[model samples]
Target: MIYENDISYEIRGAIYSVYNNIGPGLLESIYESALDYELKKLGLKTKRQVVLPFHYCGDQLGSFRLDLLVNDKVIVEVKSVAELLPVHHKQLISYLKLSNFRLGILVNFNVNNINEGIFRKVNGL
Candidate 1:
């Protein structure tokens, strides 16, 4: 298992709180909104739909938006799928690398148990 930092731990708690209240089978947007609200309620700074610009050899490339950036440290990707696929994990990893963030949490809100749907991804860990 990868080591989890304090920010990641707090974000995990916030994710669990949202999952416990909201349950499952909801759309990704819904979970995103609720998790943003929950993270703020926990006194954590959060930015939603944040655009992360990519760069290549001093050239500006297109950017991708992140679902949530918590405390400017952890990237939180919300998904409401039947199950999390490798592509989903890869997506988060790409976001983490682009954003220069070390930790990311991918939460799928379509599972019977939230624990089974939570994934912690680390970049260069």
Candidate 2:
């Protein structure tokens, strides 16, 4: 899998800007929308709430939605929980695995510092 550090840094910075503007405890949608705006402002291609289909053992397992997908290569998950639990990271990892994306961002907009809320490489980190 290709790991683009320069692009990753741009994505993280955009996510951080959104977190800084809309401090803590907002709904996931709020953060999702704000991040979408910021990412677009940075000229990075992104998609929001993309519905990805899944299958189980050749059977259709239905579809799953992602909060934000950046550059069609990274998944960005927004959370407003008090702390980013393991399950949150698991969800993002699952999304990357299921959607066949190589990487993801598990950004929890509930910490004192936005940097603390950023979890990079949800699928590999």
Candidate 3:
């Protein structure tokens, strides 16, 4: 199994490549598709728009759709909004907790600087 850090590093690289080539001002789904392509081109396994069942205390609740699940280790949440709100970060955190993943990346592709738009969140990483 690939370590979370290694997978994260590759994911970041893919993010930068997608941003550099496409720039910004695209829809979230567009960036999501591009990033998924880039990641697959980089020889990484990815599942796009994955719906993972959510449960609570042994009861089946609703479900959440992850933008991308990389190598089944890292969760990539893509956004293309004017600015990322706290709820966006909180949502990723909640997904990590509910999905039992250790690492996640929240990226907004609507900013001038992708660096500022990228955030890494961990659930006990």
Q: Which predicted model would earn the best TM-score?
A: 3
Writing each residue's lDDT as its tens digit, candidate 3 over 6-56 gives 999999999999999999998999999999999999999999999999998
Ranking by lDDT: 3, 1, 2
Q: What are the TM-scores, per candidate, against the unseen true structure?
A: 0.92, 0.89, 0.96
Off by over 4 Å in 1: 1-4
Instruction: Give candidate 3 misplaced runs (Cα > 4 Å).
Output: none
**lDDT per model, in order?**
0.88, 0.81, 0.94
Which scores greater on lDDT, model 1 or model 3? 3
Candidate 2: lDDT of 51?
A: 92
Summing lDDT over every window of 10 consecutive residues in candidate 1, give the lowest-scoring window.
1-10
Q: Which candidate number has the best lDDT?
A: 3
Model 2 stretches astray by more than 4 angstroms: 1-3, 122-125
Q: What's the CA error at residue 47 for candidate 1, in Å? A: 0.3
